[model samples]
Target: MSRRPPARRRPARRPRRPRQQQEHLVGLLLAAAAALWLMATVVHWLLAHWWILLAAAVIAVLGGIGWWQQRVQRAQWEHAQARALRYGLPQLDALSHRQFEYTVRDLMYRDGCTDAVQVGGQGDLGADVKATDPHGRRWVIQCKHRRHGEQGAAVGTPELQVLNGTGRPVHKADVVVMVTNGRITQPGRDFARQQRLHLVDRQLLASWAAGSRPLWELLPALPPPRKPSRLS
Candidate 1:
């Protein structure tokens, strides 16, 4: 453009440090020397006290073997206890109200709901037991214990109403159930069926407690098994 103003000269770049200085040669040499000395000292010590390492290795092996044997023995004892345990309607009816909730939790655990827990107490919001089945379906169970068994006051619609309202929105249950070692009134059963709620009546409870089938398998219209990632 207008003779392009006499070509401007670019300023010279600052010179780089000398190769030895830039590489930090002295520091690198010192570090290498220190590392070599440390390695030599460790090797000499290990050689002089080799029996200590051998003793430690032997102790570790013995400890591991002992731990493994104890674990196996414990597992066998648990299996024997499970085989001896039994459940029936009479057994369930004899339990106190709180014990009934714990029994339900234990049944869930026996059926492979390893995370089953008894949450019944004050402020339970109608959920007595909560568990996640092996299929990843969440369960909220309400236990109604009748000391008189089937002859006691029947489980009525009021309890079902509370469970229907809170079981899903509050407990995030995929399958909501009412478990009683007693009868549910006709109206309660009708409401439960209409609302897609599951019921474990005295008869069904007997079968579930006595048989090997999982509770989910015994109930109808359960939600499809969910992905483990989808479980809360």
Candidate 2:
């Protein structure tokens, strides 16, 4: 009997790589699904809370506007200071009563009173110029205009008494001042000294107007400068 030809052995079965490939594809699909779900959730939340986003946008806009306004105001104030006029006794002597009051207000601005204003007309109750100094002291100034410098009538105790009475109670002043391009009578000076009233007489006024020093430095016994707030 002829020996039967040996059957060729079946080729060895190849290892399956599709199984690992399928697992990787499934992992990728799952990750993609998770990312899509997260994005959808965020979109839904944003839609539901649209008003909060709108409010935030509005607040941001308002804050920007306020900041811009403040910058403009600061620029204007600095420009005013740069062009402010310097006055001499002769020029001051020529000014009318109302002009004198305004001059005092301008001088306060030169000395760093950003809020200096003239309020000397009728019903002012003796406070001619109102300001808050750089040191945070509230100043209520009463201007006494003199047409002829020291030869004019002296600022007397009656004026001081009126200012002292109203400076603190009515005008809420930390420092009350009587400014004159004239002399203060002896009695007026004594009253001012006793009541802690500051007097800017002709001599002092001359020095102040011609110098760069702040008015507070020339005067004594002023309250200490206020400390800044933490929030500020």
TM-score of 1: 0.73
RMSD in Å for model 1: 10.7
Q: State each model's C-alpha RMSD to the native.
A: 10.7, 21.3
Query: What lDDT, from 0 to 1, does candidate 1 have?
Result: 0.91
Q: Kindly list the per-residue Cα lDDT of model 1 for residues 49-88, writing each as its tens digit.
A: 9998999999999999999999999977865665444589
lDDT of 2 by residue, 9-73 (tens): 98998778998899999999999999999999999998999998899999999999999999999
Over 4 Å off, model 2:
1-80, 228-232
Alpha carbon deviation, residue 190, candidate 1 (Å):
1.5
Off by over 4 Å in 1: 1-47, 228-232
Question: Pairs clashing in candidate 1?
Answer: none
- Compared with the true structure, all predictions reach lDDT values of 0.91, 0.89
Q: Please give the range of 10 consecutive residues that has the lowest summed lDDT in model 2.
A: 223-232
